[model samples]
Target: MDLHYVVQGNGEPIVFLDSGGADLRDWEFIAPSLAKSYRCIAYDGRGAGQSPSPIEFGDYVEDLKNLLDFLDIDNTVLVGHSIGGRIATDFALTYPQRVSKLVLIGPGLTGYQFSPELVQRFEEIQSVAPNVEKMAQLSLELPSYQVVMTSPQRDRMVEMTKHNTLRGLEWQHLWKNLQVWGELPAIPPLNELRVKTLFIIGTQDSEDCFRIADLFKQVPDIRFAHIEGADHMPTLTHSLEVSSIIREFLGESKL
Candidate 1:
């Protein structure tokens, strides 16, 4: 499918996955900085930017696997944000040998199911706004809201979001992965995980995400960092800090 991707720098592979509604552009600022130290690879997820939507989340995973195979990249660092983080986690779980490290930003663990009211609000937001202004407004006012991203970053995210909606996919497809995701799948035992994992959560993120991280504390080789004052989109607002952590982790890892 020729999924759009940008590769930079001259070191070990680091594949970046954007948030569900965001494209590779979300990493524009952060990626360049990281590229100076690692061979960072960023690409648009399906249904966003230059990528096309497929029937299932597994298709998205297959696309990632194929991309790695084509690039001859093994033992890589998989970095993902939001739904992108979930995707990275899933890929690492399924193909442990291919991933040497994982960095999740404001990641949504499987156990972090949405409340009925929150789901309804999401639907309401989509129905009323259907455009960038309303969406940005919702981003600011929503109680579950976190820190408000900078205008430029918010604008870019909103622009990419225009192409990232889930239309007729239903809540399950949006939530579950062809029956591949659930409480059982969402919270995997990191004790069993061979790769080192890092979770970067915005201190202002929805409470459910925080609870999920707390729940998974038993997982070995897993660490969590709270980006104080940063919200859901730290990659946009706090790119430098995010990039520094990634670079440090990569430098310390053998792969």
Candidate 2:
């Protein structure tokens, strides 16, 4: 769909994927620092930012493929946050030769189900879906977002949340058959993944996500970092620490 994207710096390319209901700005802090040594590309997913509303589950994956082809980027590192991480995982599985490595932060997994209470909250969020601002505000109040964000960072998050919320409202009714979760038929067996992988999560993030982290133990050549006192949005709340860890991983992975 000709997704909106921005590219900076040079050298080995690193593509940044945003969380669900988020845009390229999700990497605002981390991308710039990495760009000093690597080409950093951040893009809006279908139905988010300036990208068009998604018509099917495969749309996000296709958009990414098209973007990479257009840029003539190959064997790039993919860094993704939340649902963005899930998309990266799927892309790597589908096009392993195109990906050199993966860095997944608070990634979602196929077949992962939300707890009953969380499902209720999801319904509540959808109930207020028509009011994008209210939905965004409520989302910020969720426990996952209530930790460690500075005022300015929180404001930026709210802005991105609202933008995504509005797009979702515009698309959901028309694309009701599209499955947001479980875009993959099943989680690919981790042992089959050939590229080096890093999984980072915040101790204070969702317990469900922590469970998903446990599944990654099966992945060969995988490294993990657990950030203390941070939450779901650590890329925003703990940008410096996250960036440092990524730089170290890149250097060590090269060796």
Candidate 3:
């Protein structure tokens, strides 16, 4: 499928990857700020937004590769969130020469072993099934998301969740398959990554995410930052701080 994408600004290329439940608009608040000096590209992943559905799990890695090839892009920075981060990591490892830098925000690890408690929580969430509205509402009600719900970007975040929920209902089975089938193989050792990497995590994100970040600490060329009071959606809840961190990492003067 030809994914829907938007590009802005000029200079070094930086691609923004959306979370599993979001589209390119997830970066609406943060992308423009970075786009002032860098070429920022955000795209809708398969089954989200205008993108098509029934995307095979294994096809995600290749979908991104194809997107870059079609755009004639190379040696660019990849900034990804949640499941998007998984895609970015896989891409960087598989095509190291094509990636200049990697920014993982609340990233998901490949072959992650979910805690039994987390698994139970997930099962409960799944039990709600096709009731996308309730699922979306429940997501926001989580303690991790409370901070974002009260922030200035709350409306946008809610809208994005609703949009994602609708898409989730539309492609329920495909979405479930993507979650299971897209499971990546064992991650390569951190030392093998020659490209610069940054991890920006929310202090209040799930424990599993924190554990994943701990594992990335072994990477030689990597930096870490913790956003207080933010959660998985830090890009939305803490846009200014997130953008500033990205700007600093890229060595760009503040706007």
Cα lDDT computed for each candidate against the true fold: 0.72, 0.84, 0.84
Query: Candidates' TM-scores?
Result: 0.82, 0.92, 0.91
Q: How far is candidate 2 from the true structure (C-alpha RMSD, Å)?
A: 2.7
Error of 2 at 135 (Å): 1.5
| Pairwise TM-score winner, candidates 1 and 2 | 2
Candidate 2 C-alpha lDDT tens digits along 102-203? 999999876677777777777678778588888877777778777844545877887788888888887777755645444436667877777899999998
Worst 10 residues of 1 by lDDT: 176-185
Compared with the true structure, model 3 gives a TM-score of: 0.91
Candidate 1 lDDT, 108-186, residue by residue in tens: 6654666666666666666564465566466455553445444456566555555454332333345443332233434
Decide which is better by lDDT, 1 or 2: 2
Q: Comparing 1 and 3 by TM-score, which wins?
A: 3
